[model samples]
Target chain A: MIALSINWHAEDQAWLLVAQNRRGLPFGIGGSQLVAGGALLALSAPMAGRVASWAAVNPHDPTPLLRPPAWDDAVVAAAILGAALLLALLSRWTERLGLRTMLEMRSEEGREPLVGPVSVTLGPDRATIRGATWEASYDAALLTGIEEPPGYLILRFGAARPVMLPRRDLTEPDAAAVRDWAAGVLGHDDAAP
Target chain B: MNEVSSGTPPRRPWERPVTPPSARPAGLWTSPAPDRGPVLVVRVDTEDEVAASRLAVAAMTPRGGLGSAALGGLVMLTAVTAVLASGSGWKSPVPEGLPLLAILAAIAAFAGLGWLAGAYLLPLVRRWASVAHARRVLRPGPDGVPPDGGGPARVVLGTRALHWTGPRAARRFDVALLRGLVEDRDHMMLRFGLVSVVVLPRRDLAPEQQEAVRDWVRRHAREGRA
Candidate 1:
């Protein structure tokens, strides 16, 4: 099992996570923007579709007799494409807005941290986040289907937003513990850290 | 350890007393017992649903709040467009006066409206309705059993199966086959095949009752809890 401790690096404006699992994969995360950007990128396709459909059904002139069907289809296609681009832009803007909201919520005159250090303890089929206002214990089974990207570990607990942990933040011991923990959840017989 | 904080506090009156074989009481807690055996029942009432629903929605979305944020932005844009279209002559910028922009704006406006309704309005109404139903169901009526309508909507965790009963529908699944458990501060979700049951933390219960349920869930719901 890997053992690690993490501290909020205020000067760098990032979380300084140290793990001890040399065999664990290295990824980068810790900032809210990283997760927010990734999530928005994932939803871009569906958002585009929705935007396009909306543009098609909404007519500036309520009287449909004013426009030809062929012209409407073309307009709709353009609208869909345009909506997607606009939404992509809007997603970034909102992400910034959300980050700002989170920071403001935590800052004391933009100085004191609202969220304290978070301690994670991983055991057999269980993981617990302690010393945070939103402290919780989860059944690690919920993460069975999570796909680990090359460097990132996505820890999802049902109904809560998944927390993306960058493997880069972990040390060899931490990585080993994580790999062992993930192996159990993922049901793999041969995962070495 | 500090002497002030070292020892446990005295137990409260409402709390179930711990006893040996000679001091055991006939009924320590009065919660309904599942067929398998007596387990702490977390009876979910109507209050605190908006917050709970938010947790459920967060789980269903791919990236957590991205979906909601996008929808919210779209709603704001459409609302502005709707207002502009109504006042000034808002026309489509596209060729042939297809009214493309107006149509798009209208669509955005309506979709945004619908999202808001589903996210907020519908849940509020359901919460109100459930509270109303529970009132009548728990009322001192002729029969002690719940009114002819199904029992107050609850997620019952039995030793073998997990059951959910609403006013009109009921569902149960073997606990052993449950796929996963996801929980945040506001809600706990149990997933089966494709469906999920969202169980909210009961705030209305006495402190002891709530603790009992939490202890029970920590043991039964989480894997490898002995």
Candidate 2:
């Protein structure tokens, strides 16, 4: 299992914590910390022997931002690319550290109160949110498939996505505990899945 | 509130006096008054949204920041790449000025495209932000249900923070840069990719759930402010 984290803060800033794994495949996650409404909406890794082929016609152009701002449009431009490459590098670094690639890795552990499956359980005294199946614990389970339903939370993305939980019955505190704990674990933003 | 001759009068209790659009504020800005009239409310925890939608995400990925900067950088990168690929010392047939200039022009176009992409996709992000906020201030309102519509079998992964509900007024959300999307009783139609969102009423949610719902509405308005 690989252990790494990425943080996408507001004001257009991002950070990555990359550490190599044993499978010769890197492992890591990336998203936003700030600007709660907008986070990493997409992520992908080519199948076996597909990267080189994809790179052949790779449409990505790493041109530099030449705009000269009074303060730092250029600085921001550089940071933009810097963040992208950093995310990419961190992924590779995780591989070098022997961690499996996110596409290949699965989570099996995380904080407690999380039993298994997906659903939002609310009963007499509890609130709990359950995560999905993965070989790695919370440390390596890069959350994917994030959505917004202008219906919950404080961010302005309008959405009404249903909750995910495993327990058929739950306590009131379990529901509240899950809600509070999940927010704390996932942070205020939708960076992690 | 004056009743519109036609549609259902969905006005909230606090929105007796409506504010004119002209009196609104300017740029990346939120209205001084959080309470325009009444607020839209909802309450769902891990129970309503079955784990069906849950997925893993990194703690803090710079996707939003990247989207913001993409306009500035993507253009330049594509242009430079085109110029280099045109190779000054190659048996290439493409001309120098035309190809280089074309690349520059393409850069400009790509930049615009990036901005457009960011604008259109924000609402989807905003929708999730509500759930994120709900997770933070998790509390069953009156009943032990998730929220009203959420029943008792939903799942919640996290939250951003719930905002207090504003009075009757025009709450907004930025669909894109400088773009304002109002979600009041008048225009409650939710248009998503080719589908419409069926939003429920606030009464359905528990008290705590109601707060979460109000926060979601306020946040939706705030997204536009950004």
Candidate 3:
């Protein structure tokens, strides 16, 4: 068994990304923006056309177009667009906040580290993770895939919470060995000969 | 050792269990029941249908009931505003010299009201639809079978999978693929993957059977966590 210690940080963006992906954000950031922008344009196009028509009819009298009421449509459109943008940002912030709160509660205010400074023992076909209050053994054959994202290794099992192992705690050779072992267990072509 | 020498071929990992006719659970006829363990049969009714529809919608929209309603209201408001603007000969609806803040506030208030109204009303509409669907599908005949000849609607729970036989179709949900199991006051929702759910009403189940179902869910959930 290859045993390694992990200094887990719950505040990591990698974890956030994993959490967000698992929960699944409908429309996502760019998609939401696109939908909001498209709706704004669609809602405002009629108003724009109407203004153009008014201008065409009363070309001489620019006074009506300059009135405050004339800009009501624009104001409403801008407000809606603003609300949409604000909502997008708020949703992202809320998710992160909620994740932090959940972690805090689970870890009991840092008295117990849910994933912090945990010891992991990698067997030929399974990995045993020991936390402060809990220990879980995961079968490597059941793992869907292994994600190597920058300085972390994420073990993904279908419908189960992924296990994140930071590479900083392990020696380079050890990290490589773990990755190759996982790859081999998962039947990936990149596994070492 | 020769190519011709063969007993029954070894079962593949993904092959479904071939339950014998004698061991098949009662009230299930569409296919062979999973022979993993004891089977629990739960009958379907209008309430179960309604709950299923509600749960399905909830699963589809992860933002919860209020958020989904609010979003719907916003979209509807935008469409309505556009239509009215076009109909009113392009004239501004606001009075002259109206403050931008006031206009924004009024719009926000309208959206909020719409959201509340939708949140209240959408469930009623869903319930009505579900009731109608149940009437059509689960309408019992004099012989206790469906008039449409599709047979009785029921869900058979096994250790390895869930078999749901509706009025017109049957679905098999493998236990390994189930994402979560949620039990509320009236229904037990078996969530498969993300959006698929099987709602089993507890009204027809005996207390001991209900406990058995709970125990099964608990055991599987723990295994899944492990």
| Candidate 1 per-residue C-alpha lDDT over A1-193 given as tens digits, one digit per residue, 9 for 90 to 100 | 2234443323212221111100121211112222333343333323443443344434433343333346544555455555545554454445445544544443433222323354666656445544322223444554433435666565644212244455667776776677767767767523533
TM-score of chain B of 2: 0.31
Give each model's clash number: 23, 119, 0
- Candidate 3 lDDT by residue in tens digits, B102-131: 334434554564455445544454444434
Interface RMSD of each: 19.4, 19.8, 15.5
Q: Which of candidates 1 and 3 reaches a greater TM-score? A: 3
**Candidate 2 vs candidate 3: which has greater DockQ?**
2
Runs of candidate 2 with Cα error greater than 4 angstroms are A1-193, B1-96, B122-226
* Cα error, candidate 1, residue B183 (Å): 18
Sort every candidate by DockQ, greatest first: 1, 2, 3
lDDT of 2 by residue, A3-23 (tens): 112111111110111210111
lDDT (Cα, tens digit) per residue for candidate 2, span B5-29:
5575744343233333343322211
lDDT of each: 0.42, 0.29, 0.51
B1-226 per-residue lDDT for model 1 (tens digits): 3533767575433334222223212221112324342223344433333334344334433432335545555644553455455553333453564445545554555456545644564344434433343343234323232221223544445555554444322334545434445555545555432223445454434556455445545555424311
Over 4 Å off, model 1: A7-77, A88-93, A100-104, A107-116, A124-126, A139-147, A155-164, A184-193, B1-226
lDDT of 2 at A96: 34
Evaluated at residue A16, the lDDT of candidate 1 is 15
Look at candidate 3 and give me any clashing residue pairs.
none
Q: Is the docking of candidate 2 incorrect, acceptable, medium or high quality?
A: incorrect
